[model samples]
Target: MKKVICFLAVLITFVAAFQLFRQKEGVENESYTINLRHNKSYHDETDELIYKGLLWSFSQVGATLPKKTTARGIEKVTDTLWRIDVSKLGFRPVVLEKWRRIIAAAKNTQEYHLYGSIMLNRFVICSIYASNHYYEMVQAPKTYSEFLHPSVNASSKAEYAVEISSVSKGERLIRMDTTVEAITAQQFIAVEGSGHFSQGNFKEELFELIDMMPNGQLRYLIYSHNGRLVNASPNSYGDAGKPAKCMWCHESYLLDNFMSTPNIKGYLNYEQFVSLNKRNNDKLIKYRKQLSTEINYENKKDHELAEIMYISYMEPSAETLAFEWHLSIEEIRRHLAKLRTHQHHEFPFLGQLYDRHEVDKLAPHKSVPIPKSIREPNDDEPNLLGAN
Candidate 1:
C-alpha cells in the first residue's frame, strides 16, 4: 500500500513540473512580440499577442538570403545579387522568388502573421514584395506638372528652385514641389542634379516620396534616380531606409528652412523663394486642419519615426543611446540590462540585443520634448523637411 502511494505521488510531481515548464515557456514567448497597431498607444504592450512565434525567424531568414541590396536597379551585378527596378511596378520572378522565401519564413512573426495577408492583398496583388504600401507610389509621376496639382494651373509648373543645399553643401541643383489638393494627396520630389554620383558613378542619386497617407499621417520613401527603391541615399552615409533616414532630421512635416542663393545659376532668389514657400506652407497647414477630424496628425513628429526605426533595427550601442536619450552611458546600460533582449538578425551578432517593444514601454511618451539635433551638419541632405 505504501509503495502504491509513493508511485502516485511521483506521478503527480512529474505532471506539476511539466505544467510549470509550459507556463514559463509561454511567458518567454510573449516577451518577444511587438504590437504595432496604429490606434493603440505606443506604450501599450498588453494587447492580445498579435504576433506569434519566436523573433529568431527574422534572423534565420536574413541568414539564408542574399544581402538586401546589390546595385541600384535590376542590374544582374553578380551571381547572387540582383537589383529591383521600382519603376517597373512588379517584382521580377527571381526577386519574387527571394521575397517568397522571406515571407514564408516571416509567417510566424506579427509582421507577417498579422500584416502579411493585408500587405499581400494591398502590395502583393499589385506585384511588389518585401516592402510596405508606399512602394507602389514610386511609379507615380516624378514632376509637379505631371501630378496636376491644383496650384500648377496658376503656374505652368509648380517647381520651386532653392540653393544648392547648405545642409549637404553639395553642388547639385535642388528643386521642390508641394502642390496637391489635400495633404494626403500631396507628394514631394527633390532631385539632386548630375553634380554628384555614388562610388560607382551612379547618377542622379535623388530622394523621392509621397509624404502622407489617406489618414494624413506621414510616410517617407527613398528611390534611386532610375525610379527603383533603394536602401541608401546618395547624399547620406549609412543605408537607413525610407522614413528612417528622412525622418531622422525632420522635426515637422514641412521644414521652413530653405535659404536662397540668387548668385547660384539655377535656383530662385531669396525673396521669391521665401514668398512662394510661405504660400505653400499655409496651404499644407490648412489641409491638415481638414484632417484633424479623424487623425491626430500632431501627436507624432517626423523624427519619432527615425527613433522607432533606430531602436527596432539598429541595436544601438550605449554611446549612441546616450546621445539619443540625453542620458549617460552608464544609465543607458542599466536600463538596457533590465529590458528583455532578442537576437537581432542584422547586428549584435555576438549576443542578443534589447527588444525595442519593451524599451518603448520604459519611456511611454517621447523621452524628450524636442527632436534630437542633426549629428552631421554638412551631410548631403538637399531637402531639410519636405511634405507631400
Candidate 2:
C-alpha cells in the first residue's frame, strides 16, 4: 500500500509538470498573436508600441498596400497601367501631369493662373470653348456685349451660327452673324468693294473665298430679293427688307436688353476724342431722343408690315481715326451722349467704353499713376475713376 501511494505521488507530480509546461507555451503563443495583430495596421514602430498605456498614431491604415509594400523592401510588381518595382530602391517617381504613367498622386493647391490653375484652352486661346472654360476663351477682352445690351460677352470673336432656314424665304437668313459692328440685320459689308455673294450649301465656297482673301479680312454680301424680308437690312436694293415697328419684328430700345459693363473703364485715343468731338458729338448728344430716327418708326397705318433700313456703309479714313477695336453703331451713339460727362463715369444701365472700338486703340486698363501735368488746360482733369 505504501509503494502504491509513492507511485501515485510521482504520477501527480508528472501531471502537474505537464500542466505547467502547457500553460507556459499557451501564454507565449497568445503573446505572439497579440504582437502580430497590433503591428498589422501600423506604419511607425510607435504605432505597434505599447507606449505608456496606449498607441499614438497619425495614419489610420498604418500598414496599407502601397505604403506597406514599399516599406517591406519589395522588388517588382506589374499591372496593366503600372509596373511597380521596389527591388531598385532609388527609382524615380513620375512628377509630370502629362506623363503616360502615374507614379504617385500629387495634391494640387492653387488659386488662379500661376501654378495649378488648370485653365487649359481658355479665352486667351480661342474665342469659344466648352461651357466649363467658355468665359476664358480668347476674343475682344471687353466687359460687355456690343450687340446685346445689359448682357455681357467677349468681343473679339463673332458668335458661331447655324441658320435654320433660308434668308430668301425670310426664315433664317443670318447664318453666322456675331459681329457687333453688324447693326442692320445680317447685311454684308464690302471690304475691298468686291463682296462675295452666293446661295445654297456653300460652306466650301465660303472657305475658298476666305483662302483667296487677305489676312483677317473678307468682304461679302447676301443675296436677298426685294419685299420678302421683314425688318432685315439688305446689302443692296435687291436685298431690301421690311420696316421697323412692323407687326412681324420686335424692335424696341428697352434698357435691360443691353449688355453688362465691365469694371475697368475703356479709354479712347486722343485722335478718336478729337474726331468724335468734331463730327458726331452734337448729333450724338441729341441721339437718345432720336434712337428710332435711324429706323422708320413712323406710319402707324403701314406699321403692321416689317420695315428694313439700308444701314449705309462709311469706313473711317486711315488719317481720320485709329481704333484699337471695331465700333458698334449702338456704342457710338452712347459715347456721343456721354461726352463731357466724364470718360471714367460708368453707366449702370450700360457697358463700359470698351464696347466702343475706339477703346481698342488704347492700352488695357492699368493702374498708371497718370501725371496731372498731361491734362489739357481747357478740359476737365484728363482722368476720372472708372470703377471701384
Candidate 3:
C-alpha cells in the first residue's frame, strides 16, 4: 500500500513539473512576440525575408534558362536612391509569362519597355515608355498645328519635351502624370501656332494625341519656359496651377475603372469623357468664385493678398518652410496668419524643398495608401515566394 501511494505521488509530481515547464516556455514565447511587435526591426526583417525569397526564385528560374545578361540586383546610386536594372530579370520568360495577358492586350507594343522591381513582399512589373520611343513622341511636331497650344517664349533656346512613367501596385498599374515642357522661344511659337485660341477646345488635338498612348489615362501637365506649371488635363478652373476639380474621380473611380477593364476605349467613352470634363470645368469656376469670396471676406486687404501670393508661389507646409528658413514655429505661424476656415487645413505656402538627410529619414515610412476599392486583386494574400 505504501509503494502504491509513493508511485501515485511521483506521477502527480511529474505532471505538475511538466505543466510548470510548459507555462515558462509559453511566457518566454509571449515576451519574444511582444518584443518583435514593438521593435522597428520587423520592417527590415520582413524586407530581408522577401529579398531572399526573390533571389532564390530568380536563381531557380534563371538556372534552367539561357545565361543572358539582365538586371539581377540593385545598385545604390546615392544614399537615398537605389537603381535596379530591370532588363536582366525583366525580359525573362518566367517574368514575362506572368504579364502575358497584359502584354497581349496592349495596343501599342512598341511604346512600352518592361521594368521590374522586387518590393516589400511582391515583385512588380512596370510598363514604361522606352527612352528612345518617348523622345520620338516628344519631338517638336513637324507641322505648326501639331505643337502643344498656349506656348511660352523664353529668351534662351527652348525645346518641346514629354515624359511618361508608370509603376505597378497590386493588379493596377498607376501611371504618373505625363509632363510636356516648352523651353525655347521657337518651341513656344510652334505650340501657340498649333491651334486656334478657342475657349473650350484650346488644345483638343494635343489632348487627343496623349489619350492615344497605350494605358494613357488623360492626365498631363504643360510647363512654361520659366518652369511655371501652366496647364493640366481635367482642369476644372481652366487656370494654370489651380487644382483639378476631378481630383476625387482620378483618385477613385477612374483608377478602379482602368484597372478592371484596362482597355481605354471600352471603359472611357469619348462622349462621356468630354461631357464630364466640361461639367467639372463649370463646377471649378463656381468653386474658384466661392474660394475668392472667402479669401476676400476677411477684409484684411494687405495681409490676405500677401497670403494668397505666398500660397500661389511657395506651396509648402508651414512646419517644413519653418525648418528650412530656420524660423521658429511661432514666427512662421505669424507669417502665414490668416482667418481659420477649415478644421484640418494645411498652410498653403509650404514648399517641397527638402534636405537629403531629412528626405532619407522620412522616405522609408512614406507610402501613399491607395484606396481599398482600387487595390490590387491579390494584395491581401501572402506572397507565395516569401512564404516559409
- Measured by TM-score, the strongest candidate is 1
Cα lDDT of candidate 1 equals: 0.38
Ranking by lDDT: 1, 3, 2
Off by over 4 Å in 2: 1-157, 166-201, 204-302, 305-388
Better of 1 and 3 by TM-score: 1
For model 2, what is the error of residue 299's alpha carbon versus the real structure, in angstroms, after optimal superposition?
Answer: 9.3
TM per prediction: 0.41, 0.15, 0.21
Best by lDDT: 1
Q: Against the hidden true structure, what lDDT does model 2 obtain?
A: 0.21
Task: Tell how far residue 118 is off in model 1, in angstroms.
Answer: 18
* Per-residue lDDT over 121-207 for candidate 1, one digit per residue giving the tens place of the 0 to 100 score: 111211221122123222333443444345544343344443345444443433455344455555555555444332223244565
Model 2 per-residue lDDT tens digits across residues 108-137: 212121222211111111111111111111
Global lDDT scores for all candidate models: 0.38, 0.21, 0.27
Which lDDT value does model 3 have at 30?
Answer: 31
Residue 102 in candidate 3, Cα distance off native in Å: 34
True-structure RMSD, every candidate: 18.3, 31.2, 22.8
Instruction: Give Cα distance to truth, residue 167, candidate 2, Å.
Output: 5.0
Give the local distance difference test score of model 3: 0.27
